[model samples]
Target: MPIQLAHAATLPAHADSVFLLPAGTTQLPAQLADLHEASRKYVTEQLAADSKLITVNHYSHRHYFVVASAKGSAHLIAEAMRKSGHQLHALLKADKVTELYVEDLSESADGALALALAEGIYLSAYEFEGYKTDEKSKKPAALTRVLLTGAASAEAIQELDYLLQGVCLARDLINAPLNKLNATQFAERMAEAGDAAGYQTEIFDLPRIEALRMGGLLAVNLGSPEPPTFTIMEWKPENARNSQPYVLVGKGVVFDTGGLSLKPTPGSMDMMKCDMSGGAAVTGVLYALAKNKVPIHVIGLVPATDNRPGGMAYVPGDVLTMYSGLTVEVLNTDAEGRLILADALAFAKKYEPALVVDIATLTGSAARAIGKEGIVGMGTADEVQLLALKQAGNRVHERVVEFPLWDEYAEHIKSDIADINNLGKAEAGAISAGKFLERFTEGTPWIHLDIAGPAYLTAPDSYRGKGGTGTSVRLLYDFLKNQE
Candidate 1:
C-alpha cells in the first residue's frame, strides 16, 4: 500500500515516535513533556555515548526511538539521517506498526534533517507487488501513515511528497514486467502521468516514427511484435525561467534480449525489464516539476521499444541511418540503447536546448567499473554545468563519477562502413557508448548518464530497495529546481 505523510501540528501524548536529535543531546523540549518524561530518561540514562539509535517504551503501543544526528557536509548529514530513517522503517515493519510520527528535534539543520529522514522512510517502504497474488496479505501491514512535526513544514512536506511520488513512479514502471508494460504501454503510462501532472504528452506511433525517419528506434523494435513509440513530454509554464528548454532524452528499451547477438555478458539479461529506467526517471522528474509548478521549460523525449531476437530482428552487420542522417554500423546487436538514444538526442536538438541529458542503462562496463555504488556520468558539456550536476548527485546520494569523452576514445566507435560503430573494444565500453551518442548531439551541450550500476539492485539496498532504485530522479529534480 502507498504510504501517506502529513505535517502534524503537535505530537500526541503517547504514540510511536521517532525523535531526531544531535549526538550530544540529552534534554527534551518543553513541548515534548506532554508526550512523556520517559523520552528524556531514555536519552539521558539509557542511551550510551556511542549509541546511534535506541528505543524506549512508555506503554503499550507507545514506542519511541531516539536517533542521534550526524554532523558534517549536507551529503554526509543527509546520508546519516536517511540511514537512521531506514533503520526506523525496518524496525516498524518488523513490529508490524501501522503508522509512526517523525520529528526533527535536531535544532541544527533547519528542516534539512527532517526531509532526509522522511525520504529514507518513504523510499524504504517501496515494494514491487505487481505480480504477487497473496504476498501482501501474507505479510502484516507496513507503514501506512506518517505524521511529521518540528521543522518539516507543510510546504516542505508537500514538495518532498511530490518528489518521492516521482521516485516510486519510476520504480513501479521499472519493476513492471515487459508483458505488462511494453513500448506502447510505456508511452501510454508516460502520457497518463503527464495528464495527471499538468504536462503535455505527444506520442508518435510507427507510421509517424517512420515518417520522421527515426530509423534507430525502428531498427531496435523490428524484432518485437510491438511497434516503437516516440514520446514527447513538455512542462512549460507562463513564468518560465529560460527561452531554450532543458531537454532530457531517456533510452526506453523496455526489455533487452541482446537482439541477434544473444547472451554472454557481465550484467544479467534477466534484469532487462529495467532497461527503460532512464525513461521512467524522465517521466518521474517531469511529473514532480509540473506538480510543484517549477518555473522552467523542460522537454522529455523517450524513444521506446523492446530489443528482441525474434522474427526480423536487425543483424549485427546492418548499417542503419539515424534520425540525424548519420549511419551507425551495428557491431553488436546488444548495443541497441545507443541506437535508440541517438535518435532521441538528435530529436532533442529541435528544441534548441540549453542542455541535454540522456540517461540510460546502456553498458555493463559501467556496472563492472562501479558495481552499483554510483552512476557513470560523461558528457561534452562544460565544467560549470557538469559540476552543478555532480553537486546535485552528492546531495541525493546518487554519486556520479564523471568519465571522460576523450578524443582518443572516439576512435573506438569509428566505422569504415558508417559514421560510427555501436560497440567498441572490450576496454572502456561505457566511454565508447557515450562517445557514440555524442555524435548525434550536433554540438549542443549534452550529458550522458549510464545508470547500469544502480538502476536495479540484485539485493535490497537501504532506502533504495532491491530493484529499480529510481536512481537519477532526485538528482535531476534537485539540479533543475535550482536552475533559475
Candidate 2:
C-alpha cells in the first residue's frame, strides 16, 4: 500500500521524530530542542561526523529520533534525503514505530524535500511477498503513514504520491515471474491501469499484430507458446501543452531466454523476467502523469512478448521483415529487444510525435560500461531534448551517459543480405544497437535509453528494493513535468 501523507498542524505529541538538519550544524532545531540533552548531543555529534544518525530518545513515549543531514544543492539534498528516508524506515521497522513525523530544518531551497523524504521512506518499506508462503510470519515494516510539518505544498506532495504509486506498480510488474506476467497478461494489466488512471488503452493481440506486419514481435514470439501483444496507451488532457503528443516506446520482452541463442540458465538468464522493465517504466510514467492530470498529450507503445528457444524459433542468419518493411539480418537471437523496439518505433511514426523516446533493457555491454550507475543513452534527437532528459536524470539520480550515434556505428550493423543486421560488432555494442534502431526512426527526432544496468537490482539499495528498481519512471515523469 502507498504511504498516506498529510499536513500536520503541529507535531503530534507521541509521534516518532525525523529531523532534517543542515550539514555541519551543532545546534538542534527549536522543534527538537526538547529532546534529551544526551540524545541531542548524539545528533549533533553525528551531524558533525557527516553520517546518518538515528537514535532512541527517552522522551515520554520513548520516541525515536532520526537526524539526517540535508547538505549540498537541491539534487544532492534530495538524494541524501532518499537515503535517509530508507535509513529511517529501517530504524522504524526495527523499533516497530508506526507513525513518523518529519520536519525539514535544513533551510534549503528545495520545496520538495518532504516529498523526497516520503518517497524514500515509503518506497523502502515496500515488500513483494506475493509468492512467499511465510509472508504472514515475516511481518515487514509497519510504517503506514508519514506526517509532514514543513513548507511542502499539497500539490507537490500529491504529485510525488502518484509518482510513487506508479513506481511501485512498475516494481510489481517487473518482479513478477514469467508464469504470472506473460505478454497478454502484461497488456491486460496495462489496460486495467489505463482505465484506473484515466488514460485510454488499446491492446492488439496476435491477429492484429500480424495484420500490422510486426515481424520483429512475431519473430521474437516464435519460441513461446504465448502470443504477442501490442499495447497503446494515451493521455491527452484538454489543456495539454504540446501541439503534438510526445511518444514513448518500450521493449516488452516479458522473459528473454535469448531464443535460439539461449542464455545460460544459472548465469545470465536468472533475472530475465525483468527484461520488460522498460515497458513497465513507460506504463508507470503514463500512470503518474494521468493520475496527476499533468496537462501533457502523451502516448505510450509497448510491444510485448517472450523470447524462448521453442519450436520454429528464428535462428541467426534469418532475415525478418519488420513493421516498417525494413529487413533485418538476425546475427544474434538475443538481440531481440532491438527488433521489437524497432517495430514500435516505426509504429510511433504515425503519431508525428513532437519527440520520441524508446527505453529498453537492451544490452549487457551497456551494463558492463556503466555498472548499474546510469543509463546508456544515444539518439538522433535534438541536443536540447537530450539535455532535458539528462537534467531530469540528474534530478532523479537516474543519470544518463550519452553515447554518439555516429555514422561509423551504423556501419558496424551493415547487413550483407538484408537492410541491416540486428547485432553489431562486439565493440560499442550499445551504440550499434542504438544505430540499428535509429534507422527505424526514419529521421524522426528520437532518443534511445538502454537501461540494462539499473532496471533490476540483485540486492537492496537505499530506497530501491531488492528486485525491480523502477529506474526511468521518475526520470520521465520529472522530464514531462518540466516540459510543462
Cα error, candidate 2, residue 321 (Å)? 1.0
Q: How many Å off is the CA of 240 in candidate 2?
A: 0.5
Give the poorly placed runs of model 1, Cα more than 4 Å off: 26-42, 135-138, 264-267
What tens digits encode model 1's per-residue C-alpha lDDT throughout 1-484?
Answer: 7788789988776678787766665555564665456566766565555576767666476555555554777688789888888888888887777878886677745577878888888999988777657854665667898888887688878888888999999999999999999999999999999999999999999999999899899999999999999999999999999989999998899999889999755566788999999999999999999998999999999999999999899999999999999999999899999999999999899889999999999999999999898999999889999999999999999999999888999899889999899999999999999999989996799999999999999899889989898999999999998897
RMSD for each model, in Å, please?
A: 1.8, 1.8
Whole-model alpha-carbon lDDT for candidate 1: 0.88
The local distance difference test score of each candidate is 0.88, 0.87
Q: lDDT: which candidate is best?
A: 1
- Which regions of candidate 2 fall more than 4 Å away from where they truly are? 36-51, 59-72, 135-141
lDDT of 2 by residue, 254-310 (tens): 999998888998979999999999999999999999999999999999999999998
